[model samples]
Structures are given as structure tokens and as C-alpha cells.
Target: MAGNMFGRLFGKPKEEVSPLSTLEKLNETLEMLEKKENLMQKKIAQEMEKAKEFTRAKNKRAAIQCLKRKKLYEQQVEQLANNQLRIQDQMIMLESAKVTTETVDALRSGAQAMRAQLKTTKIDDVDKTMDEINESTEDMKAIQEALANPVGGMAEFDDDDLLTELEELEGQELDEQLLAPSTAAPATHLPSVPTARVPAQAGKAQPVRTEEDDELAALQAEMAL
Candidate 1:
């Protein structure tokens, strides 16, 4: 078997190479083959064209020789094309294999990371931590509620007592006002007359003449005239 021969040649069991490295090497080889294949095709086209030119010049022997060389070149070009196609197929397989290998490696790494985390973490620790958190939360809520409600949060207002005190004050003020002096104004005032004083000693009196006495005195004076 090929495996046995490979082992015998290596003198021991052979280790496999990385798939990605193998694929890169194959890609290089494929590019080289493509270049060589292109060169071979060019040579075939040149030989065929030369054969056509010879046939047009009416040289039968030269045309026949050109045709023979063209046939050989065509055969070589065909073989190169087949080789290039085979190499392309191999490159495709290697690229697919490399992708699959990368996917498997990524999945394996993720699985290993998960296993490491699981080893360090335990369910009992999680439960204990949750219980402590819940206890702390409940204590904080109780403290907040106690702070919100202090002692004796009531209004001090005695309505009946206040009303009785106000009425007593108002009665006392009214009684003091009533006992004060009255300030009523009189309706009218009349002017007073002064009495005349009498003379203390008697004096000679001159007779005062009335209007009739004056008329009689004038008639006597006229008769005397």
C-alpha cells in the first residue's frame, strides 16, 4: 500500500502536513501550470497560422511540413489543457478542505472556552450570591420605608377651644366700650344780655319834652308875639 511504502521510505510513521499549507502550495503550482498552458496554446496557434500562409503561397511541401508541426503542437496544447483542468479541480478540493478545517478549529476552540468557564463557575455559588443580593435589597427597602414615616405626623388644631376663647375676648372688649363716657353734641346755643348799672348820687334833672309839650310851647310863644 502507499501508506506502507511512505512509512518505509521515512523509516517511521509520517506525520501529516497542514491542509492550509498544502493548499497554498497547490495554488502556486496551478498558477505555474496555467502560464505554461497559455504558452503552449500560443505555440500551437503560431504553427497553424504558418501552415495557412504556406498553403496560400502555393508551396505544397512547406505547407505539409507546417501542418505536421501544427498537429504536434495541438496535441501538446490539448495535454496541457487537461493538466490545467485537473489542477484546477485539485485546487478547488483543497480550498474547500481548508475552509472546513478552519470551521472545525473555531468550533473546537469555542467548546474549550466554554468548558474552562464551566470548571471555574458553580451553581451553588450563584444561588448564594442571589440570596445575599435579595437580602440586601429587602433591608434597604425597609430602611427607606422607615425613613419616609417619622413619629407624630399629625396637625395640632383644637377648633372648639379656639372658638370659645375668641368669643370671650370679643365680649370683654364690648363691655369696656359701653362703660366709657358719652360724647353727644347739644342742639343749639343762645347769646347772653348784660344788665345796665344805676347812678349812686341824685343830680339836677332837666325836663324832657314830649312832642305835645313842644307844640303847646310854640303856640304860647306865638300869642305873646
Candidate 2:
């Protein structure tokens, strides 16, 4: 029997009920309860009026009976009010739950989108791409530098060979300097003293042999040699 009951319970597919529809139902229930409570209040008032009439007619039992009926109506009205409060509370909870559900769903969607985006690119792939870019940049720079260089492969010169050639030139210069004439001043030509000099007075003292006269004599003697 239990198996049959469970089968029956699970046989029908559950209907999808939206929070809005549920809230509307709760609101309707609340309205009905409010109306019923208002009617009960009216009945209580009528009972009170009837009780008053019985008291005026001196019918104690009828008056007591009316009061009892009034008490029972009051209890039902209180119960209806409680039911309204419970329905309002349920509506508030449903509203809060609806907002929470939507927020959670939005967060879940965002997470899924982020996951999909991440799937498109991996860290290893990114690193490899960056390495390729860097390598390409370096290669491009090398090409540019090669293009900017002078066309002839001979643009580059060996420092050691250049220094050796400089040394050879310096040796040549030294040889030239050594083969040049000495750095002495040439003798100055002066007007030969008048060859037709008047004879000196026989008695005049001979001219003194000054150092300059000696130098002149030595120079003339050498030239004559």
C-alpha cells in the first residue's frame, strides 16, 4: 500500500510555481481572512446588541447565551487576525527569498562566464605567446641594426692591425727626421771690410784681439779651408 501511495505521489510532474504567483495567492488568503475577521466582529456586535435587548426584557438566560456567542465570535476573529499575520509573514519571507535567489543566480552566471573566458586562454599559452613576441622583437631589432650598418663587410677593422700600421708609419717618420739636415743656423754674410783700407799709422798700437775678432777669424779660416 505504501508503495502504491508513493508511486501515486511521485507519478505527477510538479508544476513550476513562480514566487509572484505564490505571493498573489498569499495576498488573496490574507484578504479573505481580513474579510472574515470583519464579519466576525460584526457578528459579535450583533450578539452584544441582542444581549442588551434580553437584559432589558429581564431574560437572564438569553442574555447569558448571547454573551457566550459573542465570546466565541471574538475568538474566531482573533484566530482570523492571527492567520492574516502568518500569511503576511510568509509573503515577506517569499519576497526576501526571491531576491536572494536572483542574486545567487546572477553570481553563478558571472562565474560561468569567467570560467568560459579563462578556458579560451591558458597561462602556458600566454607565456609562450609572450616569449614569441619578445623573440620576434629581438630579431627585428637585429635586422634593423644590420640594415643601418655600412654596406661593405670591410667596414669593420682589426684594432691590432691598425696599431701595427700606425707603428710602421711612425718608424718611417723617424727615419725621415733622422735623414734631414742638422738644426744649425747658417753663417751670416757681412760686407767685407773695405779692402782698400788706409794703412794704419806706423806707430799706432796694434788692434786688440777681442773675442769677437777671434771668432770672426776662426770662421773665415774655416771657410777658406
Candidate 3:
């Protein structure tokens, strides 16, 4: 097929050609036609100037021939313009088609890559990996919290037993207070002295009373003589 296209482009009749090759040929032809049109425009201008000079010199036959040549150049320029327009239109359409083809090929390649990735990796594997990551993160957080905590700070004790012990101590303190005054020893009573006395002569020695009374009595603060 490529051989046929090449043959078609180079006039070999048996070769095929690519689309890019066809567009390149059209561009070359358009450029050549544009150059021809420019040359024909120059020729038309020259012929018109020549016709004006001949008319001024009163040469009727030469002026008519120059006018005829100018008309022929004008017709050729019109034909080249039309051909260039057609080739430009063809190039625009071909370029648009090439861009679209490339875009579709890119999308096809991306889809194939996605299919290959899906074949290698599964949804179950993704879910398992995410679950493992979450578990590992939670474990790390627990380790960090343990490191930041004070040692033996959360040790538990029996609150009811502690309250019972405190109540026993309070009861012992109350019993000690209630028995305080009764623990003292009792006071002993003794016999009282008699108020009667015998007066003697000034020269005589006083008698000593060493004997106690037969009965004991409570003494008053003030005693009568």
C-alpha cells in the first residue's frame, strides 16, 4: 500500500502514499501556483504600461496586442487563485483529521495502561492495605500515649475498703474521748481538827495534841473559833 502511494505521488502509478505525503505535495503545488500568479501579475502590469505607451505614440496595432496579452495574464491569475484556495481548504481539513486521529490514539493508549494496572492490582488488595495502614497508625498512637503517660499513675485501689478503714479510725478516736474523764483516781478524806482549846498560865509549857478525832468531816473554807 505504501509503495502504491509513493507511485501515485511521484507518477509511478503503482505506489501508495501516506496522508502526510499527500498534504506535503498539495503544499508544494500551492506554492508553485502562487509564484506563477505573482509572475503573471507582473506581466499584466508590464503589458498595461506598454499598451499605454503605444497609445500615446499613436500605434494602434501594438497597443491592441499588449491589451490582449494583459487579458490572458489576468485569466491565468484568477485560475491560480482558485487553485490555491482549493489546496488550502484541503490542507486545513487534513490537518484537522490528523489532530483528531492523534487524540484518539492517545486515549486508546491511556485505556490500555489502565487495563494493565487493573490486572496487576485488585480491589481486595487495596482494601487490605488501607486496613493495615489504619491499624498500624492506631498502634503507633497507643505507643505514643503510653510513652507520654506517668508510670503507676493509673493504679487502681479499693475505694470502699479505704472508707471502711477511715471509719474505724474515727470510731476509736470517739471512744477515747468518751472514756477520758473516768480514768482519773478518786480523792481521799481525812479527819478534821477540834476548835476547843484550854488556856494555861503564861509560865507553863503548852500540851501537844497528837491524837486524831474518832469521826472524819468535810472542812469549810471559813471555820468559827
Off by over 4 Å in 2: 1-10, 121-225
Relative to the true structure, candidate 1 has a C-alpha RMSD (angstroms) of 21.4
Please rank every candidate by TM-score, starting with the best. 3, 1, 2
Rank list by lDDT: 2, 3, 1
Q: What's the lDDT for residue 179 in model 2?
A: 95
Best by lDDT: 2
lDDT of 2 by residue, 4-59 (tens): 89879888567999999999999999889988999999999999999999999999
Per-residue error for 135 in candidate 2, Å, reads 12
Evaluated at residue 3, the lDDT of candidate 3 is: 85
Q: lDDT per residue, candidate 3, 54-83, as tens digits?
A: 999999999999999999999999999999
**Clash number for each model:** 0, 0, 9
Give the range where candidate 1 is weakest over 10 consecutive residues by summed lDDT: 187-196
Q: What are the Cα lDDT values of the candidates?
A: 0.79, 0.89, 0.86
